[model samples]
Target: MRASLPIERSLTAEQTTALGEFRARWAAVRRSTTPADRSAAEQAVRLAYHAAGLERPARIVWCDSPLALAGRVCRASHDDGGNVRSRLVDHVRRRVASLIERRVLRKVLVAVENSVNPADPLVTAVAEAVIRSVPEPSLSMLGHLRCTGLSWSGVLHAIIAPRGFASCAAGPHDLSWLGVYDYLREVLRLHAETEPLCGLMQLASSVGWLQPHARTCWLAERPNLLCGDARDRLHQADGPALRYPDGWSVWAWRGVEVPRWIIERRDQITLAAIDEQMDVQVRRCMIEIMTPECYVALGGATRIAEDETGILWRRNWLAADAWAAVEVINATPEPDGTRRHFFLQVPANLRTAREAVAWTYGMRAEAYAQLVQRT
Candidate 1:
């Protein structure tokens, strides 16, 4: 059946469907906002440990949220009381590493790429979903109180994951990769060793982040709140877009992760605060949250120039400096041919829209005006 998948130029025909029948299950797992079912998830973890040839943990720690569990484990991992934790981890599932991961992934890709009806809508839809769902979770958002910020699914799914929880000062990595591989395994039945794959599928359907020790394991509950924008980014306007029962939450605007104050203390978002932000994406989101007109009015900005090039506005940002910016329409049209407007901060001293826009590129206005069209 493995060679039959590609030699026949399809992993499964519509009659032998793989993607359609399996997409819903993986999608549900990825988007699930329900609390973890403790009994089921614990059993799944034990199943994984057994598959890895480790004994079932004698203790189970139930966490209110993945974020909460991650924070706890991370702090404890840092303060290892004289190497006690390290000794336990040495015998845990880290030894169950992947050896046939690449080969398995290659087989799946070849079957899909060489499928008989590669252009079929169902095929295209499933391919897009599978490719886009390869999660790349950011691990650096741990330090700041104010903080913020794959297509190769199977290569990562073959073994017990979070391979080195003992060393991870970093937070949780989601089970999305495991979800993808599980979908493929169940739908297409790609011939790899069965036990590890079955264990992974159970984990994919059951839990969020996990940490295993010799006699004990920690597992986080699923997020109680998960939201996304039309673009499929984590997003919500009124509150934390992603939140767990323990109150660990993330705030975002459109897709940009923002400080919680932008949503909670919105009336206090000042021009100075926005200007002080070094990340332009966060700054833009702050302005949008406050509304551009209100942000400009609050800063006492005055429109200085306007023309085909752009509209320029300037205002005092500090006692010693003026804030200047240009609102330019994108030269490229949208799919429906409407242009989107962009507001770019520029040098305060620039006298005109053309000059301000030109300065953004390290060029003189005279030089910019001669270009055929601007991107």
Candidate 2:
């Protein structure tokens, strides 16, 4: 139940200053960074560790994309009598066993997302399968939450693999919410522009996407966004001074509480190993996958670049960071709607037995394990 940060040895002034310099250099050099940039940043950090005469942090790997697997099954629920869920679950069990046999590890993580409309039977079944996978020491059901209601819709949750509690802990600042938001938004926009959502909504609905009637009823009790008063409030809040209103600040309503299951579990999840490279204020953990390489490149420099898929990538992690930094900016608006600001930066739990099959291999350690058997 304790959520506060644990006390740790504070860095010396010299070390602290060095850290700041490193971050600035990272941001600057990363201006054109891409997936390649991510690896470069890690390399830079590694070089810094050696130059600073500090020990490199150990890398620990973790996993959590469980609900993603369920999503695959749910998408196929309309086909072949919708037996995909059962088949998916069976695949998950075998995969876990296979990982165990490979001596990967004992514990795995899993997650499920809350339904916004009415709960769907397929989602429920997926949840059940995921829950059953836990309980054994081999599995640890960290927690679950609802999508922030932005782009993820029903597909934001995850589960860790080879279960056990994370050996390291992450802090709020260690997270890059702006990075996440930008990544998701950019991905959605690209997909929409190219393939487009097409029948996605219809497909989801046919398979129980909008079944959360209770949720809809609950949300209906709140104020509407179209009202003049509401508009005024929104306008005042969303002004230049505020950048974009804080997600919680604007979306929060009185007398309404997100279910404990949603809030108590996790605010962020990471796969990176615990290390000195992590921001002190952020909450992050190590995963074995080679993601920071991709993320670094995606976040730092590659502005308006095309992804590997040849799709236009417009998601700006820096912009998302800018929006999140509004609170930090603490801008005082003049008669005109503008405020000068200093730069600022900052920062899922889920359960279930649901599983996914990987179609390929030769990824990083974590990615390889995920894809080994299915491919």
Candidate 3:
């Protein structure tokens, strides 16, 4: 359980300076919207296996997304429905998963602290603090309020991954910790093994998610159209947040992942559909897309309550729970001589629109009442 090196209590002046340099370099990697460097990724994967003293795979299978590997991994654990590829991939996974973890991931994932509980105290805490202090959103993606300019959207988020995949590389996103290692290495001037670290970086920079196996490696191609909001959360209002070359796409609103229909098929995100959504955030996104004015006027939103701040509206689904929103008019008039109306979605506990708008601003109703809001 020993750490690779002893980290000091605080970063030195030079080390703190290196943090910015590394953040910019890593952010470019995470923000890459290029196709996978197939030849380079293949070479890197082979070199990583060699560094770990494992046999190089006979072939590298190119996939559009991690979901491709995930799908095969799921079928391997369950029924393959007569898919020969699934069966073969499943066989390879069983034979090599344990071996790869012990021999390959263990050698390079030192950054993940061998255990989530690192032998070194405060390693994760320090890592968190270092990343979160940066203003760049993608670089500080794992923490809250790391970037400016964003009001509320994407200030917080969750990275949900499918189960069944074993230890693997997450392309550039792996830089979240790898860059930390770079910082530490430069700062401390430690003489740790360099081959494994280099191989990890090469693999991460050349491909998307990577899964190694006995005979073949699964390497996902980087999305050709990856984007993020101000807070560095995956988001696209008009189309897919991230889209792979093979037409595979993930749609998002603000930062919340939702169905493609909610983003594109505007006519389909009806009041009934919004009410049917169990996740409150996803439903709110739908309302945002539909525009609160249309949602209430067309969908028969009842006026539940009203106050000086706004009017509260509610609608109950036939078989599901009810939804509530606060309608507030923007005090500022547009060039066309009309005021803008905004609908703020609030928690179920809030009764009045005043509380709802106040919640959006992250304040108590009493405190918010004392000030005037333009929007």
Candidate 4:
């Protein structure tokens, strides 16, 4: 449980210059004459930092108000009428101005979750308003789109287990991914200790959030001196650390490859019956497990290993299943000299492993020989 991740080296000249430019632009935006100019400048900051080679680092910073325009424009419907749209634009302008002043580094990705029922009129209206004010190809839209073809287990499990998402935006925040893990683990343990007398909760959700509209967000700032091999090690050492209550879950998918195992397992874990749909895609997989201990742990489908062809089995409070494929995207050296392996475990009876793996990956038994190979 204890480990020391090496501190990354300093920034490159190009990155140094990029950061300098970002600062200058931000300063100007802070002094801008109008909201429109300010919002435009904010967008520029995001584009510039992302364009640079910054990877996931520790802590992400940004001003919520300034990025409002980009948020609003992207969510507006064409038929929502010009007045509503116009208001969204103005909101964006004001928000952008404030954001520049806040000095939020562009190296962070922001997610807003609607704590209210998705159907709540106010929630919908706010979401719409935020969306309407955003710039083209809204950040949220891009992030969600990247999640397409991924089952809920794929998304949520990845959030819980360690792995890199293919389309993670930005870098790390104040709490390194590993730090966040410890934080969550402690929070979960404490929650199980106290709370209502309804028995100890065993999963992630057992840790309650103070905010009603709870969501998680991710940011990956490329640390200096961590690239190529070292970067790969860093990722394996600190993959997909979660920051809960960010209003949405965010994964920093950098230098991480897809393992066929995870994809295959997903096929078995899905809600669809074996013959319910063909040439179909599975959206979410839910499993419930009843343990003899009277402690139930929910398992969500997950993408586990980068080298293998199976889904990582991930368990959280929502799942009731005992065993599942949790994907291991990265590996870190342990205190006893053993590698601290991170895997996405998916729910499966021992008998179902092969079928689940095959179904998800679409590979023949002979082809799966490697997966069966004990490392």
Candidate 5:
């Protein structure tokens, strides 16, 4: 019996004639008495079938006469087996890698061409203040503190505030309020020259670094505080206080406020008596001012943004799950008709901070090239 051709479409006269000749050749080869001749003929038929785009049956029986013949034929064509396919795959991979590199290079060039100086007086002032205020160890600890997934401001307030061992009287923990007073003394000593107590405390409270009780007091008593609007908004929403380890607590209102007392008495506060009151409170807790080196080390990254007014430097740092960001607006006019002063905003966690710093450094060349291209 003659095998049926696996053509999907109607064949032209020439193709039909060619197929007839091929079938005849196949028949003649099959009729050969010698095993070797029959083998060669079968191989030729299988190759022809493949070239004609005929798909083999899904369930192939190698031992069956016709199927075995086709299998032998296909095997003959692939004597080298898989080597060519692997080389082709590798060639495609290399091409893809090259394409990606070229694209990145182009993007970097574009970025550089459009770049501007990101330096601003505000950024400098904030950086300087951080450097002067925070110690290295304390700065490093910021990241770890963020890992707890609590508010940075809340933690800061807890560190700075006087301990309330009296509050923990019901708990298994035994503590002393004396330690709180001692800690305050140390804080006064540390911040004696640079910042005022009221300012620091107020800043901490405003930023969510203060304990719930203290923050509530500030908000209730000083309803006229700069964060009055924020306080009102929070009050309207009625959020719950977040508690942390070591008796630290904070509410949802995280706003920026600069108290008038701090501005006025910043230079006048004296730390003369703080030394005598110095005790274990400072040593037991983690509290230090932020510094430039520590900030950079903590993975602070900066970028420049331009608008109709001028260019601004945008700084970002990672802390735990959150991001602490600041924008240094360039000579931009405020609602108050005064140029803005330099100030550092929020603090970030450690790992993210480190990663940001690393990424910025690693991409510096590409970034510069892009900025240059923009110009």
Candidate 6:
């Protein structure tokens, strides 16, 4: 007979109702006589328990039928019907107890991770107790450890960086542990008071000596501040630093060499230019563009094919060269005398395709418009 396990935590009224439903279903399944029907019913019972947030025991003893087994055993041993039912109930209790044990261990692991001081006597005692309770640690246990930040609890850990762990080992220069706490508090206060996307690049760039690591750390901690599309732009390598619509710009990495053009045009690349280029492309192609806010709503200067009738400008081509390979396509004229238009074709793999198109179009339009206005 399997030992009965106990529930570790109290269930709410809703969960209690769910558990009762699961028990009734399980009993019905166990009473089914047809082999296929019994098997399917047993599966339904397991699913119900899972829906109630209880994991069934991995191994369960299969019997022809609980009543049949009990009758045979009672007949052979001369036992009463009451004793047989008690033993059957014990099986169900044991399954519940196993689930509770798993839940308690998970709670203990979470408590350990959230503890401010892992060395606290109570924390250490509880952690050790949980660790020792499992006879042979399963992969699920290891997965839990990884998730709860306890995977390295008993292992030697190291953080290897090119500059060594000086900042963490002895703390950063002029900044003690308490001082770092105060600095973070100030940062958080400023972040809350000001617009989320404003001044991130400037603040990170101004943090002398810490510029390289500051941006990475800040983004990691407050990821919710930037939209997903805007955040992804920073990961590209070839383009000039991108400026987000929210007024945040990419922070320049320290100790890495950058092209002169990127440095010169860093402040010139704007989201407005990108949007304008996308607008032009949509108009030229006569194709509806899906604007998911991920790719700069597609606008920008593109290279016109030699046969196209559109105005060709040297300045537009030069600007386009800075971002992606552009080629124009000309199509048959429309009945209204307006020619069917095609936008510039840019290689998809170019990291700066979106930005380049935007910058080029913006520059060309601005230059030509200025000339016309002056004339």
Leading candidate by TM-score:
3
State how far residue 161 of model 4 sits from its true place (Å): 47
Q: Taking the tens digit of each residue's C-alpha lDDT, what string does model 1 give over 235-277?
A: 7888987776888777777766678888889888887888788
TM-score for each of the candidates: 0.61, 0.14, 0.66, 0.20, 0.15, 0.19
Error of 5 at 239 (Å): 19
lDDT of 6 at 218: 9
Quick one: ranking by lDDT, best first?
3, 1, 6, 4, 5, 2
Superposed by TM-score, candidate 1 places the C-alpha of residue 335 at a distance from the truth, in angstroms, of 26
Most accurate candidate by lDDT: 3
* Counted clashes in each candidate structure: 0, 51, 0, 94, 28, 9
Give the per-residue lDDT of model 3 (tens digit) for 32-111. 67887888888887776665556676667787866565443332311111112222233332443343343334433343
Model 4, 2-65: lDDT tens digits are 8743322333455334443433332222222221223333333333223222221122222223
| Cα lDDT computed for each candidate against the true fold | 0.57, 0.23, 0.58, 0.27, 0.26, 0.27
Off by over 4 Å in 3: 1-12, 70-163, 166-175, 185-192, 275-280, 318-320, 333-339, 369-375
Which structure is stronger by lDDT: 1 or 6?
1
Model 1 ranges off by over 4 Å: 1-9, 15-17, 74-107, 110-174, 190-192, 275-281, 300-304, 308-310, 314-375
lDDT of 6 at 31: 20
> Of 4 and 5, which scores higher on lDDT?
4
Cα lDDT over the full model 5 = 0.26
